[model samples]
Target: MGHSLKKSGLRQTRYGSGSFSSTYKFALLISLSRLAIEKGQDSCEGLALEYTDIAEKFIELYWKQAVPYTFNDEGQLILNQNNDKQAEIVNQIIKLRKIYSSLELLRRDSEEWLTLLKEVECTVKKMPVRYLQNINGQNFEFLYPLDQCGKQLILLPQVMYCLRQFSEIIEELCQKRWIDYIRKNSTNAPILNQLPNLEQFMFEPSRNQLNAVASVLVELQECKCFYCNKKMRKGSYAVDHFIPWSLYPSDTGHNFVLADSSCNSKKSNLLASDEFLQKWQERNEEQDLVIVDRISVLGFLTDKERSHKVAEWAYTHAKENNYQVWQG
Candidate 1:
């Protein structure tokens, strides 16, 4: 059943098959999968998601890419997201990025933020939401019914379950395809063909943002390594993903930990041991408010329960597959 669902879900992503003109389809699919994990449950029940919520996800997904991607310290250019013109959302976000240094700052200005969200919501509903399920000129309503939903997108029963179950695979596929779309776009291919680490630039949180987060973590963790409990000198510690980004790419506030360089390097891309997991959970519970207040300002999403849910999903997948766990 899992294999079947994976196949079906993957097929939906390739609906138009190499004819994508814009990245909206990829963005919408990713938003749905992440929302399934963050908002839906493990059950086979249908989930109703507001178009506004999905619009916010689209903004988050495109926000980083809207900035100029620097190459070789010589030049910077924003990758064109459409064949003929920059994506409307990307263009809008690029303008906003000029005014606001980070996503959180834009979010804080409720007036401007609401205006953007409303615009994005209209676009999402009118564009990808209308076309994502169309396969080879036929409407394939595997995800949701197009006619029934008005203000909210309702995930068909078991669609939510499959999205949650296969989120990692789905996310990776979406990202790879999104990257391919950028690389193949006639305007981008000339310059982006040789760029390395394009995936990191497209998805990962910026180093500057992470550095700002590290400052808050340094104070919160009392200057000790999160894993070893060792006191670390200033300027030597790194902000480590308590849940590695390779496992789950999204950055949530409580999933960060201050680790010394050694531990951070040694534990790269591996889930921490169960003991550390417990400690991390305890730390989050204790510092939930502090993390939300501090880190959200730095442009990271911060919800302790949501972070814990993602952790639960990650750890379960790890244990089932006997994934290597870092012991510190």
Candidate 2:
């Protein structure tokens, strides 16, 4: 997915497609197999790395099978997998991985192969975290934030894809008693919190990211309330997430919008009072033109009032519009 790190211009790096490296694609397959034996399911990436042998094998297979390709059809665009040279490399890697996996379980490994595999595995493990950390630590805050340890990076689309994939994997694993797998790597259990759960299996935009998106919505919606088309006047219009934070804390960004306080609050969490919903339905889903007094919309409401209602409206609106909603 988008999160897969790729080298960009001027030695700049970008998130990967979440695809395994050619030499290491089989590593994922082997890792899954090992995990199934231990926990009866595929293990999370972090959890899988706890076993050096499994991790090594996986990386080896990925590099071996990950041969890039080319298309002789001479298409307008030559995809990476279609590039002739790369494809050959990838095919070779794939073949090697298969051969290695098919070996008898009790067979002894060749000394050269074992040594090379260990080196490859360690290098793969160390390189990514280091690269991501370096990028994040760099003062250059271009469009994306990179982790100092190179272990974390974000790509809007890649992050989305990973979330979907992770969700799918977690759901599949749920069919088995995967909880018992935790015992195999107790030292890493604390990190589980960092892993996404089924309910929150997506990245939540940060305050800055949310704000950036909100600003875009303001401009795109022409500084008017999206629901009512009411012209926004003075001060910043509130941006709210379409999905209420209360119900879905994980979903955020570009999906938010600008709205007058009354319409905004009524649309809180994309829901409102029964009476409001009735009126909304009556208006053919148009936001009610009759809004709360301008005084209230202009921050005249009490802190408590805003905290309970207006704040929710603001936060949700910000999120829906993809503005960075500051938590503080």
Candidate 3:
């Protein structure tokens, strides 16, 4: 039998709950859902997630938002994450951003990186993790128990399955709510009136990082587009996500493919055909070592197994929903 899940409870906590003081709740939900996909299985068993691991996810989620958002060439301002003040995690990331240009650089400094993780873990355990399941004045306790989780937060039985099963919905809902919280914050009101693609700004990988990835992919693909196999001249190709970022937002090294500008644009936000999917899987299997050795240093997660698992999920989802497949 399939695992039983209370979709209503999840909805109530995320949507019907009272106003939020900070965006932590949304981040926590997104983190849990993504972790469920990455670490847990589609089973009815409970899953124990380390506090430090959760903290790492928190950093990745908040890192981009900590930077100043530029609007209309006037000036740049960091969006406030809390009603009263900037979120603590965001402030910490902002401080680190001054010292490091990319997450990969900061990660190389073991001392500073570990310190940030420790701090973030403490904040996460104290704040959102403590109060996420609380609806109104009562504790729902549907996701996890507050007191039972010591070193790690344990997802309740069937929670992991439900999270994985509904990952896309959970991700979209959290992102939308997170954006709404930022928009509603009084501090952000003035600057966000004409906000341009807040979702992309908040979630998408940095353009600089993609450019760096493009350079590596050029060598990997031998200046040939993965889709058309056509020779790509300098400055004529782009790094394309094998599984669309819109489908699965997280960047995994194995999911990237070098494609000419035409194929990249044509394949925008659509799953490539089955022929391409098979080719992508084969490429990852053959070049797993090279991808990990080279691309992981570029700051992308480079697990071939994990990337393939995500692709399996994405393609399965597309098939179920009859999503249009790009015929490249």
Give per-residue lDDT, candidate 2, residue 224. 77
* Model 3 lDDT per residue over 1-102, tens place: 122234544565456423678888888888888888778776789999998889988998888898988888888889999888889999999999999876
lDDT tens digits, residue span 48-74, model 2: 123344444343223422322212344
What's the TM-score of every candidate structure?
0.93, 0.25, 0.89
Off by over 4 Å in 3: 1-18, 273-275, 285-290, 319-327
Best by TM-score: 1
Ranked candidates, highest TM-score first = 1, 3, 2
Give the count of colliding residue pairs in each prediction. Answer: 0, 66, 0
lDDT of 1 by residue, 115-231 (tens): 999999999998899988776678767889998778799998889888887788888988988888888789988888898858989999888998999999989989999999999
Cα lDDT, model 1, residue 119:
98
**lDDT (Cα, 0-100) at 71 in candidate 1:** 87
lDDT of 2: 0.35
